[model samples]
Target chain A: MKIALLASTTLDMLPSLADALARAHGLSLEWYVASFGQYEREVLDPASGARQFAPDVVLLSIDADTAARDAKSFRALASQALVSFPTATIFVHNLVLTAPDVLSLLEWNEPESNARMVAQLNLELSGVALGSDRLRVLDLDRVVRSLGIQAVCSPRFSYLGKIPFNKLGLQAIAGQLVTAINAYRGARRKVLVLDLDGTLWGGVLGEDGIEGLRLSNDGEGKAFYDFQQLLLKLWRSGILLTICSKNDEWLGLEAIRTLRFMVLHDEHFAAHRINWEPKATNIAELAEELQLGLDSFVFLDDSAEERALVRAALPEVLTPDLPKDPSEYPTFLMGLNCFETLKLSTEDRGRGALYVQERRRRYEAMGAVSLEEHLESLQTRVRIRAAHPSEFGRVAQLTQRTNQFNTTGIRRTVDELRSLADVDGWQVLVCEASDRFGDYGLVGSALVAQSADGPIVEGFLLSCRVLGRGVEEAFVAATESLVHPGRGVLLRFVSTNRNAVALKKLVELGFVLDEKTGLFGRVAPMELPKWIELETVSL
Target chain B: MPHDNIFPRIQACIVDSLKIEPGRVTQETRQEDLEEWDSIGHLTIVLSVEAEFDASFQMEDIPGMTSVAILTQHVEASGSV
Candidate 1:
């Protein structure tokens, strides 16, 4: 990735950022220095012959003190950058406000005062970027605060008595910048492995029982419930949910099934190995069951021992320390940034149900169940809707969050999805699933383009809930029926990390695998299976 | 206290500037530290502090005055905190 740095003043912290960026696998940096005074003419002018090369990422730096005055200028610069390079990711650095002159004006003698100011600036700057989808605001303040804490606590840095965070904080800030860049580039964790006992609920379910659990309608219990709701929301937003608990499996299942006020039911968890086993072993099993790379999992547990066990056993899995207090759970969870989704889709909201359904299939398979019997029992209804203005938001979200089941795993923003909808040759369709249990919401989406050979499936994805229900077959049938009449429509299923389940559907639909690309393609007339019912809505 | 009436004025400053309920802006309330105390809201707090106290703060002071206690102390020391 080619990054261009745009600072209102000379970036005194560029070397640190450059060093960190060099350590990153595929990152190159280029600097563009323009003062706040010359921002209007110099920064806005695209063909001014100043920026000779186009950059993939643009970093805009603003001073906290002057951010108010420079906010409009920065917005304009961002707008210009978007027009110049639509694909480039723009990051706005929270302003750094510190200096002896300014400190004297505030009339405080605290040595860490400057550091506090920088944190405040970054927080404020993040607010500015919240309105624009084209720009992502980096929380430079949090980065600095963590570094300050590290500097104070670390034995190596203890001798540097009261090191002002502003002077040497860039090193840590640069590391965070690289991480954020990588996250934006789609290099992030796929699964969030949660601990059951104190992490998910207030206490162990085995001990607390159904009504005894600390989950309620108000106060601290409410906070835990709210946190569970947030996790459920994240699960729908495409982060695979798994549980690693040291508990009686029967009691855990009973609590999940019987607890009335439980925000996260049994359906919320995709994979779990609830036993009195070491958390590391359970976590490894969960990863294997979900078929996700161990490195793409983030383990969250309130217990220090459990976290340490997972961290020691699987160093690749990110295990962030859970906050001591329950009140800090929201902030601590939000700070993970592991499952930072750039887009939300209709398919995402029903993803939890999909995973639960997939888990049920696995359970049935253990009983030596026939695939046909399971399909027949599903009573699955696949609703195909055209890309309308009302459904645009969810469609775009699905395009962003559908990674494993995604044909190309390419993410698209709302604006890009809108552009695709407007394009003449493209057809975007969203598939919603409803079964015996409940409505699974929008579970699948497909994007196809008119090609000379036939209508080609550009993008195809199904919510993991509707995975084993032969919904993918219905999706292909729906596409073939919509695009071509009385003719065979060619469909392509590209393999991805989480999409191996999808390959089964291609085989079921008579798609032959290509020897060279390993991608399955079929030029046969798509047949809507009798088990799957399709309802088409005009938008 | 020399600035007994200042607390209510500060509260009013926050209520009017931050566009929050007047009841929410007590002397104990922090500026951007509140859940709704976001970027534009933070700027409003800065402007409100400047207007209520009839004092101008350097760009550096904005970051330090996040909490209610800190802002009160700063205002008291400067004859406007």
Candidate 2:
């Protein structure tokens, strides 16, 4: 990530903050910190450091004093940022009042206090950014309040070099800024694998029985109930929930089925592995069933032993500590930044329904004698066509979230996807899958461009729910038929930590890897598997 | 606190906070002698020493306290650690 730091005050604390943020997000940050008082000249000039830096993200930090002095100029900076770099996303920090007591005393009997004026200035700045897609307002006031205003600022540093924030304060700002960047770029975690017993409810299901379990009604049960309600809200907003519990399957089922006060039932969870096996094992199996990366999971268990074991075995899974008291669990879980996203697409809203459909398909596969017979029974149909204007948001979302089966793992925003769709030769094909179980809405997408050599595939990905049913081969064959005859298909396979399944599938389908470019390609007469009945149509 | 024992602990805090070499941050090291020990670095070292010793200093005393020997003396003079 390339970031250009533009601040009215000294930028002495950003490097340390950037180091911590970079390490946490598994990203490298190449930063360019411009000299103080250069925000205007650097942004306005055509050949200034802002343009020459060409950063992916630009962070503008200005103090409350400057904002109060000229509110119009403060809000104008966001527009200037957008006009300067049309593609780059700019993060402007909202003003934090350094000396509220003095401001309150000086602005007495006025319509609004100086602090209120600064608040209004921040609101107006946010209003400006709200009208533009490439600009965002970062709440420095929230950062100040959360980290404590006194601890975040140092009088000595401010007096010495006009540095506004201390080390911890700068770190808090960097943390929030990186989260905003992740939300913008679509690198958010997807699944929440919650534990049972002390995690979900107040007591053990086997010991307490269905009627005896404390859930959501009285005293201590209200906390558990509230947490369940929170999880349901996440579920409704498109977060997949699963269970990994060490208990009798029937007992767990009885608790979920008979607990009338529980907000979530057996049907709410996408999958559950309830047995005596280690939670680490069950979590891995749940990831396989859901076809999500371990990095995308957050494991919540009340047992310190269980949390430690999972942390040791699967370091990628985020295991947040739970206080011994059940009352604090809800607030603790709400504070986690594990599951954060800027926008929710249609596919996200329908994700729980799609998982339910997959469960039915799994049951159907269990009874079938052979793999071919199982697929034949499902009556699967994959519709390959150009991405429509209505599905642009979902297409962009799929590019961001579909990591396990993504070939290149290249994420695109809605505007970028729309521009690509408008191009003459670029065809963004969205795959809609349906079967006997149900309709899995917008399960796959591929971006292909007509090159001189042939049609070069920029990206190809399928949802895990639609995989294992010959959808991969069917989608590929449909894509091959879309291209002009006698022209070969060039496939690009960019390896990531979690896309091995995609790479393996491509290699199995006779796509040979080019040693030089590290991309996969196959020529004409690419064979399509007989089991798949594929169809292609123009949008 | 004994004045003799404060030198190594202050040196450790300086080395750790500034990310400087361990043995090189001796009692003789001054703010002007090192490149990273600029205005901000000086503040960081002072704040870090305050935090490490659980002490506080006035804003006026910070600019004068630059060297390891002088900073250690200032921290001891705060008398709270």
Candidate 3:
């Protein structure tokens, strides 16, 4: 990753800390740190080194004093950064007051104290980057609040090198910077597979009945109650919740639903396996049923033995140690940066509700006379169209999340898709599907382009929620009409371990693979099922 | 606290911070002896020593305390360690 650092203060000591943090997360950062007082020439001039470097990310850090004195100029420079680094994801540091004491004395909207100026300027910077996917706040204020204000600044270092952060402060800022970088790379865990016994409440549910579990609105139970509150926030933010416990299914579900102080219920979890089976086995079953990879799971259990078993059985799953005390659970869970996601669409906010709708679909499936009859009865429709700038977020999200039914496992950020939209013969296709149950909003995307050999299907993927209803066949057939049709339409497949089902669908659609060339070719568009009504537009 | 035994402990901290070998440093080692312990690394060494010994040095005393022998004396003077 290329990171260009621009700061009003000297950043001589920051790169070593930042580089070490990046390396720990398997990222090698190529950094360009500009000299002092050259922000104008470095960003605006065409021939400057920063402009030529064309970074993947830009970090702008300005101290509280400099920002307070020239708030207007810094805000203008931040706005220009969007135009300057057209494709780069820009990060602007929010100013922080150096001293913690006297913070309560400052009045709102008053610029007399440096604390008030810093707070007002930070709010304005947020206003500038509102609703923008490329521009983001690095949030230095949050870091300073966590570490005490005095811990972040050193007068000796500031005098010697104009650097604002001390050693501890540099470590904290570097850790947060890497979190933003990992978020940009789409390296986020999707599912929180939690264990129940002593984790959710104080006592084991089997040993102590649901009435005896220490979960209430106050006292020792307040610790567990507060822990559930944070987990509820994660559920609302689109993290899939699941249960893997060693208890009776009926009893566990009773405690989760009937308790007065319980913040989560059966509807919040996408799925669960509350049986006496080993947790690792149950987690693998959940992964298979959800059609998600094991790498996207985070397992939390109070028992050290359960955590150790999951870690040994599935090395891909992230199992962090749980503190012996449950009161520290909320703080520990909040400190984890694995749940970071950049953009949340409508589909994200209603994800848990969508799973509830899926249960209804499953019940409807069981009542049908046959598999073919059930699919046709659902009334599935597939719509493929030219992707607009607004739908790019959903399209990029599908590329990052889909694993099993993908033709080519390619990941593209929203910024990458924006740059690709300008090419003459390239098509970014948004595939939205729906049935009688509910709407699956923008579930798939395909990358098709008019190459010298003709239109080639470069990338294709769909959400597992919309899998079994001839959607993949409909998507491939629709791509044929997208490019010039006279030449033979071609598709490429690179086999991944999870994508064997994709190859079966391709062969079923009459695409024959040439052994010598390793390319799948079809002279005409394949036939779609009568149940699939494809809506397409020619480029 | 006995001040005589703290020199080797301070030397270990400096070697660990600079990622250097321990054999090259004695009680008399200074900043000029190693290429990695330049001006910027001087700050790293000072921070490591402060953290290791639980002492705080004022700005004026940092530049003059360039050797393990001098740093041990400063660590004694800060008196918190």
Candidate 4:
């Protein structure tokens, strides 16, 4: 990844610091820091070093005074950068109010003052980010406030090298920019493993016995409640939450179930290993069960010993050090960028509920006498519909997140999904599943592009959550009937590190496989199992 | 020269920032002598020296502040650093 920094101030130390920061976070970014105060010229001119650099990410950084003087210029600069490097992700800085001008307190109170102007600039910049996905405001104002205004800015430094910010402050800005770039590049953690006692709530479940737990609406317990609310927000945004606690399962369940003030319930958790086992083992087991990598798991625990043990054993798993004080937990968790994501989709918002539904089905399946009775009892209904404009985001998410049952292993972006939907003779369908338990949102998608021979399945994938219930076969059957009618639909599967289930599903779906080409085709009417009760819907 | 307290620190800062040999950075060594001391590297050198000496460099002084001797003199003249 190449990163170009175009700033008004002489941030000489930023590039190396940004590279180091990016490298620390497992990103290899080549940095190009333009000369001081070259942002306007570089962005406006096509031959500037920024344009020549052809970076994957461009950081447009300027001080508050410069931005306030010309807010429209900043916006124009961002637009020009986008025009120059169309594919590049531009991160423009939102200016922070530092030293006061001659007006001082009067200016602070005045709406038309420099301070207000900067605030308006930031507000408009935020609107830009909201409107366009390619552009983002780095929120350097927040970064400066975090580092403290008096500490980050120095009059001597500002006059001396045209360097407006403190050394560490520049480093912090670069680090944050690197993080934003990485997030834009689609590097994100998928799962968060939380410890119950001391981490989620303020007491041990066994000793507290659900009643004695310190979870409350106010006081020290409020911190734990606040943290749970934050975790719930993250979970709702598609971050899978699992528990790895060293406590009795029944007691943990009791605490989760009985606590009135608890923000997270048992249903909120995707999986749990609430037993007296090493948390490392439990985390590994959870990772396996969820079919996610250890690198994608962030284990948050209040216990230093537990954090250290997981950090030592599974070094890939992120174990953020818990703050010494419980009150700081919410703020601490909020600051961790491990769970940052570029976009949120319908699949993401409904992820936790879908997992909960899966867990319920699993529990029911465990109790049933046989597999047939368990699946039959599920009363699963898969609704296949044409990909709507509202569904493109979830369709893209399914392509990115679903690995096990993803045919062709092709990850499509939201734009790609939208364009594919519009292509001539192409059909993109989203599979929505609901049963006696719950609605599994948009669980799968199939992308088929028409060719001379027939309609070729460019990509097809079903969420592993709905795998065993014959959703994949039903989807294939529906696709064949919709696309080819009487002729065979050409199915293609590309084997990936985690897509064996896709290949297996293709085989089971009656697609004759060519081992050499990894292509599957069915010339005959799709013969799906009678058990798969699928209903087709309109666009 | 040995008595001047800032010379060794300046030399160290130069060597560290430019990734050049310690001996390569002497009183006679210009910014052009080191391959890494391009325009971008010059800014890095000035900032690094400023950070090392706890002194700030004026924009007017930046062009002449390229060499080690000039940098050392600038820092020493600032006095407080």
Q: Pick the candidate with the highest lDDT.
A: 3
Q: What is the DockQ of each candidate?
A: 0.01, 0.42, 0.40, 0.34
lDDT of 4 at A470: 70
What is the descending DockQ order? 2, 3, 4, 1
lDDT of 1 by residue, A76-187 (tens): 5655655655556678766543433455645455654554545555555555456555577776656655555443122211112211232235445666667666655556
TM-score of every prediction relative to native: 0.63, 0.85, 0.92, 0.85
lDDT tens string, model 4, B17-81?
67688989887778878888876567667766777767766767777787877887788787745
Flag the better candidate by lDDT, 3 or 4: 3
How many Å off is the CA of A184 in candidate 4? 1.8
Largest TM-score belongs to which candidate? Answer: 3
lDDT of 3 at A448: 79
For candidate 3, write residues A438-488 as lDDT tens digits.
888888888776677777777878888888789987887777676655555
Q: Candidate 4 i-RMS (Å)?
A: 3.6
Q: Candidate 2 local accuracy as lDDT?
A: 0.80
Against the hidden true structure, what lDDT does model 4 obtain? Answer: 0.79
What C-alpha lDDT values do all the predictions have?
Answer: 0.65, 0.80, 0.82, 0.79
Candidate 4 lDDT for residue A88: 72
lDDT of 2 by residue, A311-381 (tens): 99999999989889888876687667666676666778888777867876787678899998887888887
